[model samples]
Target: MLEPPDADRLYAALLARDPAFDGRAWVGVATTGIFCRLTCPARKPRPENCRWFADPRAAQQAGFRPCRRCDPLAGAADGTPDAAAGGQGLARRLMAMIRADPSRRWSEADLAGLGLDPSTVRRAFRRQFGQSFLQMARGERLRESLRTLSGDRDLIEAQLDAGFDSASGFRAAFARLFGHPPHLMRGPADLAADWIDTPLGGMIAIADDAALHLLEFTDRKALPEGLRRLSALCGGRIGLGRRAVTDQLETQLDAFFAGRQPRFSVPLRLHGTGFQRRVWQQLQTIPAGQTRSYAGLAAEIGQPSATRAVARANATNRLALVVPCHRVIGADGSLTGYAGGLWRKRRLIEAERAYAG
Candidate 1:
């Protein structure tokens, strides 16, 4: 179990009954031997008697029972009426059915046949997942195809199994998402994309058995272009599914955010030009909470005149925090271009500084 840092901040959130920390943290009270959500209505405990945990399971493992006042086990306190809950409950049931057999095409008529109002179902799912039911089904189908492609199956076989009627149709859909056709894939042909939810936001991680190929925030503008370049380098074999490296990355990210781990041990598959590879290697050599200039990095690479080139390579880096591009500030110590945004860069640098101290 990972323990979050900044006890004072978490205690402040508890005192204010902040709902933002509900699912991300739990408070275990020593006097009552019970764990409650940060938004729990019960009286706040003394700072010395309060023990913060990352999740409810951690609290339970530490021998604390759930507080009867606030059912932390049942998600956040929405306070929705029973009628709304009942509709969402049906939507959940329908989602489960689709997940059970993602290869099967589900339609609005299908929901109506099950005694559900299609429009109501659509709204409920959209409100919860930020996507309509049909879009979710399409995503599931793509995931199924990716799972099949990870095996020894041929493209045609994988496409048909994913409920696509024609190879051309499947190729178009795959290209739209990954920026390449299924046939151009290289490497192990078992690449998978995993969505990871963090305190900052949602991130997408792509990996194969050997190493992590890509890790970027979902909202990054250059994400599609990066995917295309990675596919071209790997001979176009990217897919959607989790591998050993992805699982390890998820755990390491959790630890890193919790201030429990300072460095990542998950192997990376660095696909880039020879010069870019050298620059990234040098980036890894940078210590946490430190900054370097492009000229310094270029000099370190034995090409002091290649400062502009080094900055270009840094901008092209897709591995966000892992590659430490945020550490490479301007020569004047001004924060410069970062694909994940300068605000995020500032936050990362500050977090590292705090952790180091």
Candidate 2:
């Protein structure tokens, strides 16, 4: 029932038909008595004829029908949360079950005990979250176990808390996500990995006491290998926790997404070659709401011949928003490549324009 804080921003997104707001926002056209997704293909409505709502139900309640072109209520039919509590769909009920006892190790048999088919639940969850329901349950259990790691609980205790019956099983699951076994993280931790949820998506932030080390979207394909490399370098020093720098960076990120000029003061420990560091340093100079071509960026670094290398360095940047690698585009003025996905790059560039001046 709550409107987005900035109607102007949502309206801009509607005008642009921004795909980043496709699922997160909807527009109710007062003139046409219709509500459509932000990415709807219908002709744009005038500003005075627009009303904003967080979800389709709110728009419908406000006397707007779903647009025939966009079919904004499709997510509701598919069992995705159109409302905060969500509909009484199978996926929502399963999520409620997971919340009731997150530490329980859910199995196919457990689902079958409730007269549910495993494959049916898997497909429903996969359609909604891109992962099977069991994977989601494991993630929930892992989070419960991770919370215990900050305390004095031993690894055996943590394993039991996560519902893992064997030490080896727990270690394997932990290694899969963290890139190292639990025993390798025995010493006093100097670097910590924390999850930060943003409007774009979930990001994993790794930092030491002095500076932020890495910040990348959680779903990035390179994330697992990056963590593996970091684990090899830092050895036993990194684990699940957050440092003061993490707190500072999270605060800055909040302000940035809130349409403010973020002064990213958190110290950065860039891990790259000398040439790459130079490229990244030059990238930091590209002001928000502005873009630089790979060739342009290469020229700025006194390496006009190294445009391809500049693009490679840009691709390898682990600091998501802090370094502003999203500002780089193709020389022909197209968004060529962004590790965070082009939709996010477009959204970031659009959002930064609010305070770019």
Candidate 3:
């Protein structure tokens, strides 16, 4: 059981019906349709109808439809608020600074200066963000390295431009993250790409002329599958090959960052289970920047009650950006759980919304 303060905050979200806490807390309705979020605005159900969980994932396990008005998943998660409240909550502050500056190389001393115990900073960041602060910073820096390397910039200059203080550190980080060194990025000069900084972290763009072909978050689980499929799709000898198409896609990505509506018309080479492919196909028709509910997606697939199955398929998608999995949200209009993390999902959608203009 959570402490009184924690429980109270969850309950208050229920009482005031704030959508901000939708995915963070769920409310069970003993009587009507199903469990909902504290932010559910469909008229308060009976006290007997009210039960709560720490997150929507739990509530969904209990089989609840998002209250239509509250649309819990849309405004689902609570950011690391404990850090925001406490005096210089070191963990939170360090995370915030890192999130804001992905290219900065933060030292232990720097983190200690931020009011965090150096060791604590190391462990907590891994626990919260799935990686050490330094690990994540390196990932971000490498993204810039990849973007520059695949473009017109010289390899050595790209390494320096990405803020690598030492050649050895830069080479090591590059090899570790991208499976190759900055100078060895030789296969394709034609493949276009750019580094996209999202709230969740950074992602790489791999596309050709006329359309955006690939967009994969370096850490996304779908990455392995994408690589495998790429080999198969390109006929087994999967090596980098530069093409004019790559440059076109890079320009398209640049347009996205600049808040311009994209003009991508390239065909995406997607791979997944039949069901997942079906779901992804549906996602493509969803427009460049609109959203759909998990339930709505299931219904569209002619499996009106198989919303969970649809969500499962979505989770397994190997082609991340090309398939546009981030376009899907919870039925109640709230953002739902995304394998890539909720924050990145939100940023992707928000960024795309601007792109739709």
Candidate 4:
């Protein structure tokens, strides 16, 4: 567990019931052995009896039960509707409509027509997604265009199909974001990158029309270099966007983290040499809640003498949980060489073990 926060600041937040600190910190009362959110409505505890934790998990690990009144795990200040919920709901509804028909060009006038405040919708979407509604819609349109292009559709057709009114405008936007014009794309077309938020942290997912190329925690030191290598290997530019494969991967990850799913079915676009691909494929076969030594993986891949090579391939793997590289350990059974950090690797292995039972 991490060290607790400053006692004075946490106590101030607890006394004021600050909603801003809702998920950031939890206060545990030593006398009652209960943990509550910073915004808990219950009376604040005295300074001497209070302890601050970074998260609910930490509080739980410290032997504190959740307080019934606040239910800090739910990620809301109280059971009542939050001030941003209505606007957020409307933004989500609008997003759904936009995603359902990527060819549609939505505008502020459309929101007004729907009896919604345009500014409120914009603010809510920006707050939740960190982008304007129009930007997201454009990304969706670009994703659709890429999918169409993968199907051998012509550039003009793809542009119109993606809701763009002008060919030049489409070409410019595509080039600006992807670092290349759409017509210049060759081969199977590489992957688009998207961010996925998980309980552990934010992850970067890269995918194309047909398969997921990579999924790695954002904090991995080698991620940027790996992405560059993938772009060069696939002969396609990487841009900020999503594809059908990425969306599916996100859903599967959500289930896997929730312990409701044990395997991923999203197709993979393994971008590596035949030997490395074989190593990654073998890694997937090492079921959840199990660990394999580098030597074991080398043997499984029919290269028993290439344990070091197998370990190197595992270290280079960009797909983290889906590829199960974390399942590979040292010959002595110690966790080793996970780019996502040994702490995360340990937690992932632990979660899988508990779920597998």
Candidate 5:
């Protein structure tokens, strides 16, 4: 057990339901004889009725049962706040449902039918994965349709399988994800694109049998352009599927997110200028849990004056965790720009704390 802040400050945090205080403090209510997280949505207790504990164990030891409303004990293992755990748990359940029936079109009504609040589901998915649950379901449907199209099946069949009533609608949805209509992407392909689910979000991995060419979050703004570049590089030979490289990458990612130092041995087909390649190579050399400034990275690449150029290269990196672009920070140690979104960057850095030497 640890000491909490002054009672007034603790009460203020409980009132505000501050996420920063999550896992760092637990509050017991005297009237109710229950303990809850500070960020619990339950009604706040009066200051006089509130008792602060630094850890859940302390609160429980003080003759307070865990509050069922907040389920404070649920987060004791990893110290995840109840609200965040709720979002992530909801997102996972939805993702599993989407995967089980990739062709089903999900909507607000469907979510409601499953006893989920539409707006709450929307916020949960967006916060956990940076996209709405509906959008993720739609993308899964599109990927299913893409597989059908690439199998040399009729385009009409593919469109119908996507749960779209019309070809135009299916084409539009497909183009939004891949930067190309279904017709254009169909055919024998040398590079395969596959979906990978991470704790943070869904990512699309593109690879040949030998090496991974790109791995990006599905919601990344640069993903479509990256796909276009890949298409051009592979002479328009890209389709929906996975190769051994993708499987290997997935395993490595599993280890990484599980708090182990992953040895990323999957061969990479880096597409960049010489200077950019040097910067990426230097990035891989950065130990997990350590960050480097653009100037520091530039100096490591023997071009100390190319800090801006280094930053640009970092932004353009197509291989997300494999290249560790999230390890690069601003000169003042700010997160700076990450193509994968700043929220994910922050999460990755926090996750890697276990790997710090």
Candidate 6:
């Protein structure tokens, strides 16, 4: 029973057949058994055929196929608290426990004792989260386990430390997820992260839960890989680790989202080719609110003919606002490729521009 937006707002968008409202909400046609974003290019169906929902995942469970034009699988506009909680209000708590000790194991009875039916929790998670509770729980634990293993702890200790009842389970999960075993994990100890909220949505800063990791858009394709790199670098399990870096980064993120030109000085942990890193480093010098072109950055980096490479590097940057890739635009002053999606890039630039002005 999630309510749609104001009736007039929805009505107005439908009358105009607007595209801007597409990801923010959806229309489900009971008659046709299809769901569509407002931007779906298909012919607008009759108003009587539309039963609206805020997201397509819900509509899909109700048995509506997504319109091909607007692939609902792009994911919802940042999960809401209810979406985050998934009705049990345990997402945060569970996330906390997992982060607190990624290697820790909780039996079904233990989880059920926390006021959740194991089967009900499983179904709710699968329906609302698209992952079974155990799977989600396992992935999270593996992250932390990997993080811990990468540290001073050796492989066997790290394996057992990550809460795997046996070394075999730990090794199997690691090999499956990272394409390698724990010994491959390597990197510095500096943690990095930054948070931002845009008109489209909010995204958390990614890291080893200890040091800077990936400064990713919540909805990007390579975000998962970025986390893997961070976990690999940390050589330990990466369930939300408690760190001073996270606290400072969280505060700075709040300021950034609030339109403040806040100074952020967290040490960075970047992962990319030497060329990509060079482009990103140049990007960091673009000032808090000013922008530059890829051509400009390429030339400044003494690679004047590498404008395209620079663009590709920028496009591949896992970190978003911190590296200031959003500050790079086309030579024509038009916006260009941003992995976080153009909408978020536009919103960040606008917010920063106003701040600078």
Q: How many residue pairs clash per model?
A: 7, 0, 17, 0, 0, 21
lDDT of 4 by residue, 1-357 (tens): 112335775787688785435555688999999999788899878999998876666687899998999876552333223322323445567777887998887788977897666676665565445456777677677667766766666778889998899998898766654446677653443567766767555577888898888888755667767766776777657655678898899899889888788899999977788999999999999888789999999989889999989988998898888899999998987778788876566557767775556
Whole-model lDDT, candidate 4? Answer: 0.74
Enumerate residue pairs that collide in model 5.
none
TM-score of candidate 6 on Cα atoms, chains taken together: 0.48
Each candidate structure's TM-score, on Cα atoms with residue i matched to residue i, is 0.53, 0.71, 0.52, 0.51, 0.76, 0.48
lDDT rank order? 5, 2, 1, 4, 6, 3
In model 3, where do residues sit more than 4 Å from their true spots? Answer: 1-105, 113-133, 144-185, 188-194, 197-200, 209-211, 221-225, 235-267, 272-275, 287-290, 303-309, 318-322, 332-334, 348-357
For all candidates in order, the CA lDDT equals 0.76, 0.77, 0.60, 0.74, 0.80, 0.63
lDDT of 6 by residue, 1-357 (tens): 012345445655766655435445677877778887666667777776777776556777779987777665443234444332233344445655755765667778877687565775564454434445666667656656645754577777777777787777887776665445555544443443333433333344655444555665444556656666766766645442336665666677767666664455766767878998899888888876688998899999999999999989988887677788888988987778787767565556655754566
Q: Which stretches of candidate 4 lie over 4 Å from their true place?
A: 1-190
Per-residue C-alpha lDDT of model 5 across residues 1-357, encoded as one tens digit per residue = 012345776787799886645555789999999999898999988899998886666776789998888787652354444333545566777888899999997889997897667887776676566678888888788778756775767889888987887888988877777888867765568998888878777788999998999999888888889999889988889977779998999998888777664448789999999888998889999988799999999999889999999999999999999999999998887678788888677667766765774
Please give the distance, in angstroms, between residue 116's alpha carbon in candidate 4 and its true position after superposition.
Answer: 40
TM-score of 4: 0.51
How far in Å is the alpha carbon of 33 misplaced in model 4? 16
Model 4 residue 343 distance off true place after TM-score fit, in angstroms = 0.6
Question: Can you write out model 1's per-residue Cα lDDT over 75-165, one digit (the tens) per residue?
Answer: 3234333122423454567778887998987888987897666776675565444457887787678767777875678888899899887
Off by over 4 Å in 2: 1-20, 26-35, 38-54, 57-64, 68-70, 75-140, 163-169, 197-202, 240-242, 258-261
Best TM-score among the predictions, by candidate number: 5
Best by lDDT: 5
